[model samples]
Target: MAEPLEIGSLQIRNVSKIFGTFKAVSDVSLNVQKGEFLTLLGPSGSGKTTLLMMLAGFLDVSEGDIALDGASIAGVPAEKRNFGMVFQGYALFPHMNVRDNIGYALSVRNRAVAEIEACVDEMLDLVQLQQFADRKPGQLSGGQQQRVALARALCFAPPVLLLDEPLGALDKKLRVEVQEQLKVIHRRIGTTFIYVTHDQEEALSMSDRIVIMRDGAIEQVGTPKELYERPKNKFTASFLGKSNFIHHNDKVYALRPEKIDLIVGVDHQDARMNGTVSSITYFGSMQRVIVDTKEGQKIEIDIDVWRNANEVKLGDAVDLLWADEAAVELQMG
Candidate 1:
């Protein structure tokens, strides 16, 4: 078992970052619980990285304070804050072997030789990299180098770990494998994890809670299911997953493609609309059906591959039905 590290809550109080007249992050306040896996998710230029840099003490806050366990750490230097960071590029020294790379943090702090060795061993085991301990970084693959970076960051047993798209460098298959290992490592060590990613699928799959940012402000924050099923605004609805917006009674409502069903005959459904099938695209297990409705809206529906063009032809009139509860009312400004 690895040594248990102290973890605590982090509070960001009305934080903002400014580069000249433009606000990179605007009046953001959030609370992160101890040992929780919180993700900051957004598209490019959404200020997620700026916010993370402020939290890491690498960038000064333009307004408000950052507190760790009720004490302010905004004025502290990045190195003195006792936090670990892993970047997307896997910033490992090329000359150092795996064991030396993992032990560098401890050595910098002047820890005893025996203590550093023990900690390096524990970290190598934690990341399943013991066999590659003697190999230099140049000899390892991308995935292996990333694992080494993670082990190096965690070997010091920091209270919090900040990852800036650490898995973005790997291929799809290796990325998925590393993602599973990351979850396992987090569960085993119970450290507070703050991850930043633009990939919606990754955020949905890995985060305990997700904060979505847009134009330097938070659009919404919730669990994956909450964000997917009930979005507070149209941007949140569309960004988190596929959504079809319907204007009803001068109000905008969002419905997911999977929630809307296609009807051939008069079947019981809460709400129904008539439209012509504009297009059909095939996926392995599912098919995407696009329909042009009489209401001047193009609706997209996802159905099982078992029900395809054999039953519904292009330009054929069909009924799109869904439950009233399936439509989520949105507050669009």
Candidate 2:
């Protein structure tokens, strides 16, 4: 069996990347804890990928420094950094079988033949690809091929693993399956994983903490629950999940769809709004009801499908109620 890897932490300080005239990434500083699964999440051109490339040493930092375990690696080359990388494209050798591809890193380092074989076996087991060890990339499915790519990058026991949307090529169902597997592998290996993806669900479900970037700067960095429940700004609230912004009494507040209750009459003392049902959308597990308020505001509420299937419909009058604490105030941007 292979020994456990020594997990490492990262410190990104005032990092910026400029291309002649345009600044791709601006003054971003972050600290990643040891063994934490940190994900950089945002839409295209948000600079998430650009920041990852700098951390991997593939791109130079226009200004600022990056440190691993308290040591500066700003001058280190990509190969000498000893960080494993997995990209969207599998990039596996077409002619090489699973075992050879996984063992290639060790073989090139001139490790003992027996040592290489043992490490390869461990990697195959780590990714649950033991049965397909002899299959070539062309013979395996897309998901299996991606797993092989993961094994190859991890075989040498790099302290940190950098992934660049590794599941982007897989189908929805297959992508979810691989995500669960990746989390299991990370737990067992205890390696610090810095994953990059634009999928909000992916970041919310798998990451220990998420860094939401916009334009070229950091918008917010917090755990999934923290960011979802209490967002600091309009961008963070709307980007992380669906939010209904309420403009009342010269103040702005954000409320989640699920937090609002729909009732036939406005009898309670809590915050309430009266509106006519505008539309209803069926999503299998829950129903989304859009209400057009008398004040000319459209609010969305999510109700359980089984409980509220026939309780309300389009053109029906309803009251939306919620506790005062459920409405989170946001700083005006």
Best by TM-score: 2
RMSD after CA superposition, every candidate: 1.7, 1.4
Candidate 1 structure, TM-score to reference: 0.96
Estimate every model's Cα lDDT from 0 to 1: 0.90, 0.91
Candidate 1 achieves a global lDDT of 0.90
lDDT of 2: 0.91
| TM-score (all chains, Cα) for each model | 0.96, 0.96
Q: Candidate 1: where is the Cα deviation over 4 Å? A: 1-3, 265-271, 306-310
Q: List the residue pairs that clash in candidate 1.
A: none
Tens-digit lDDT track for model 2 on 1-333?
A: 256655589999999999999899999999998888999999999999999999999999999999999899999999889888897788899999999999998898999999999999999988989999999999999999999999999999888899999999999999999999999988988889999999999999999999999988999999999999999999989999999999878888999999999986545455488988999999999999999999999999999888765788789888889988999999899
Model 1, 65-150: lDDT tens digits are: 99998899999999898788888798899999999999999999999999999999999888888999999999999999999999
